[model samples]
Target chain A: MSELAMHEIDRLKENLAERAAAEGLIDVSYRLVDSPVGQLMLAATGRGIVRVAFAAEDFDAVLDSLAEKVGVRVLHRAAPLDAAAMQLDEYFAHARTGFELNLDHRLSSGYRLEVQLALPRIEYGHTASYKAMAAVTGRPAAVRAVGTACATNPLPILVPCHRVLRSDGSLGGYLGGLDAKRALLSLEQDPFGN
Target chain B: MRLHGVKMKTNPPFELVVREHGPAVLRMCTALLRPGPDAQDAWSETFLAALRAYPGLEPGANVQAWLITIARRKAIDSLRARHPVPVDSLPEQAAPIDGFGPDGLFENAGLWDALGTLTELQRKVIGYHYLLGFPYAEIPGFLGGSAASLRRAAADGIKSLRKLLDVSEES
Candidate 1:
């Protein structure tokens, strides 16, 4: 193997990685980010951020889920996630109130979809009871269903599902785990048991 | 590892294919085409095409040989494009491929120079068998030569390259 051949191959890899998305080879692009909560996995489709998984959730398992649900054209590309990472950095630092990134919520659907869609309406730095979220989703009697939705929220913090709490304002179960839920609520200035 | 109702058989991912055989394809491309931008273009095009065609590629196929064959065709296309039949006046001196580019990719300039003089078939035969370490028997499927003939041609190519390069180094 000549040094020239090695150089050529490296250049080809760089070229491919740089241009794969534009070339339409990469369908789902993702990246790993560090946050106060933990390492977060950010994956995006052509439309927007599709999945945001917490560290407690194995990143590989999350990726495999994305592969199974989405297409297998997945790649660890950082270009699409660059703007999202900066926004999330501001978010974890408590400097940014809400994410401005477009999101694709195809990871969940039906009643769960309605609950997830209603979560962001809780507003940054605000907490909502499961009953309140259920009412907002036009399913006032589905408070328990709302809890299940918040519990199973695939996008978690990015979708702001962590803002859901009990009617008494007690910290509720979070899909990312209790500690992560508390950490996110704390990051948003939600005092415990308020 | 699957979704409900729709059963998809996952082929080995293309990334593995690239990591495994990319160097050989690049080297083979450089051997057949001129060792510069043209060869580099050929290499890129080969993989880009392979990536497009990968999903339908038959199961348990020889991936390396498949990639090499694609690179071979790409290199030939690039060579023809670069050496378009002389329109009015024949250009003086063949294309300059004696050394590495702005970056020092070639450790040996004499060998690079020697490679440029070999016929395209000789170059492919030698690149697949000698440079890539593919068995002679495996190469015959991608290339037209029998194992024995490819062995002979590769031997002759190496001998000529050694003689040409050794003489040039002394001068």
Candidate 2:
């Protein structure tokens, strides 16, 4: 039904995306990236990466929350997420250990955000107890709160929330399910073997 | 990274809507406003408006029809915003776009020129019905006329195009 050349449509979409960003009509840009874990939906604002969702998480529900919590101008454009996508690809390929990507922390706040921000310091291939996370956040008495923080982490793999374990060194709850948590930990422990 | 199977959602990302209907909307705008900043503005405005209101759209709403309605309104708004210089009194029109050559809508310059010769109603009728595949019965609501008159306009528009492009005698 389209008499316009395919390239013309593509060009128009590109132009619209650029114009939308220029006009601030685009607050959140997102796209799906496939990783070893599963299909990941990555979303970002002009500020930084805002939300990351595993396939197990209902993408529609995630999008609705982003619209409600962030802004209604979320688009499925990939430009803003290009860096995150590349880094994620490298991560899945075992070529990267730390994420140097810019993160927009607006989706989180208070103790939850504090716990999530401290997750990267746990070091790659190393696991930490929720008690340790609470201690790191200077809330040594809030071990349960630390667990809640890791459980509700908005950034997921990017924030390394899977690094947090129970005090007895047991695999704790993961938003992406236990298997995904195990897989990520194993990937970090022995990148080439798994 | 491995391409893991995606869990399907009944509600697709908004980009799919843009990709699906963008070209047709652009073509409609070109036919309605011709190739220029005006057409581009109408196109951009339509999609921006659509994107803002998308989350609240009814689950099974007719997406293309809804977009067409918005595009038509945006085109009308653009037309109204233009300075009312008489078509005959205006200076010779400059080239509409710089790089919209082989990659854009007016690659068939002759066809675009032919389309320009038709009356506004003829152009809209031809664009909505023939180019964008809008039902004949539905053309009236967007462009305003009975279906019967729109069908006549479509026929007359094509006749004019055939004559202007000099394909009638060959056939």
RMSD to the hidden true structure, all candidates: 10.5, 10.9
TM for every model, in the order presented, reads 0.64, 0.64
Q: What does DockQ give for each predicted structure?
A: 0.18, 0.17
Tell me the RMSD of model 1 versus the true structure.
10.5
Q: Give the whole-model CA lDDT for all candidates, comma-separated.
A: 0.71, 0.76
Going through the candidates in order, what is the number of backbone clashes in each? Answer: 1, 0
Off by over 4 Å in 1: A1-11, A166-172, A190-194, B1-40, B54-72, B75-124, B128-153, B156-171
lDDT of 2 by residue, A2-32 (tens): 4456666677777777777777778689889
In terms of DockQ, which candidate is strongest?
1
Predicted candidate 1 versus true structure: per-residue lDDT over B25-95, tens digit per residue: 66556676566787778878887887777656765566665675576567556644654532233222212
